[model samples]
Target: MLLQLISHSLGWLSAQVSAKAQDALIAVLSSGPVPQHVAFILDGNRRYARSKNMQIKEGHTDGFYTLRKMLEVCIHMNVRCVTAYTFSIENFKRSPAEVDALMDLAEEKLLELCQKGDILDKYGIKLVVVGHRDMLPERVKAAAEKAEEMTKNNDRAIFNLCMPYTSRDEIATAVQSTIHERLDEDADDTVTADDIEAHLMTSLSGSPPLDILVRTSGVKRLSDYLLWQCSEDTQLQFSSTYWPEFGMWDFVPIILDYQRKVWSKA
Candidate 1:
């Protein structure tokens, strides 16, 4: 009993120390230019689950907690916009049971965020669900709309949750919207690149230009996420850490490297 107590105490103390160290580092990092918009491609939840011999749902749940923690870190860093590639349209091809589990989780989490004193309320962050609403389960779609409506007035920060989304689809939708609007106004149907960009989901949601896009589990590809939004200047960061295990420390180096590159360019 004594040994167990001592071990627990030490663990608690170590965590506290680590947290303080992280806070100090963040403060220093904040002294420099912080990215206005940062996007994350959440990957490797299933692989992480398999590695730990746990259910895939448990891995996703763990990833959600990691995401919450990373958002808090981003908020502290005063990142104006944070976009997470929560789910891709291609993810729908997964087993029906897995897809159903994901939908249930999304519904639960969206409603939880709408509750009083949750992350959205605590940080005054606006929750924007960016994707095909028709593609989501009815319950999930309702929960997403409710969350968005509840936090529409928040102006402190913006969180774009991209689920059931694909860059190709977004571009096509934007081009279509642009052409329809022009036709309705009796203008020529020539849709310029700028016109399509103005109608992009990210633009409609008021998200800032993406500055950095990080994909975990060492995945170097964008996987059809935000293809149009990623300009030549956007930094692409890849981490070997799985989504479930990603933490503040894992993110710090990326930010530092971004700062170094920006400062060097100046």
Candidate 2:
């Protein structure tokens, strides 16, 4: 009982310190060039699980929790749009068991997104799952659709879940959609860059292109996420920490660095 009490007290104290630090950081950096849209390439779940000798599901669960925390932080920081690479189309190549687990997690998370106290309604954040719905499991796809419907009227912030998504696939689909729409209208057959952008799956947010794209776990490459949406001016920040270990406090420093370094240059 005494040990538990001590642990609880310490946790409370830590949270207090964290809260104060976060507020200070925000006060200083909020007036700076905050990202209008931020996207995350969440990596290192499996590696983290392996390192800890824990079940892969646990790592992914932690990653999801991190994502929730991230959204709250971004909203507080006044970021307009947030996109996450939840499940890539290429993830289908993983072991059947792992893929099944991911699908189950997605279905569960989507349901959670609609519940009270989950922040969707609290913050008026709209949720959109952009991907190939036909390729997803029925239950998962249904949950995503329901979540989108529930939050369709929200306008405060846009949250995009890139499930079963790939930049290459999205680009190709945009091209096809643009062409088909042009044909249906009996208009010009030429497909311009604007035409493709108009039909992009992720562009539903109607926000500016990504101003900041972060890939955690030390990976430098985009791994096929937001390939076209990240403009040349977008600041790409790579973190050494795993997604599960990333927090709003950790993110503040990166953004501050970007302001001092990248934004100044631009």
Model 2, TM vs. native: 0.94
Q: Model 1, range 64-139, lDDT digits (tens) per residue?
A: 9888999999999999999999989999999999999899899999999888899999999999998887999899
Off by over 4 Å in 2: 261-266
lDDT of 1 at 188: 82
Q: Which residue window of length 10 is worst by lDDT in model 1? A: 187-196
Clashes of 2: 0
What's the lDDT of the predicted structure labeled candidate 1? 0.93
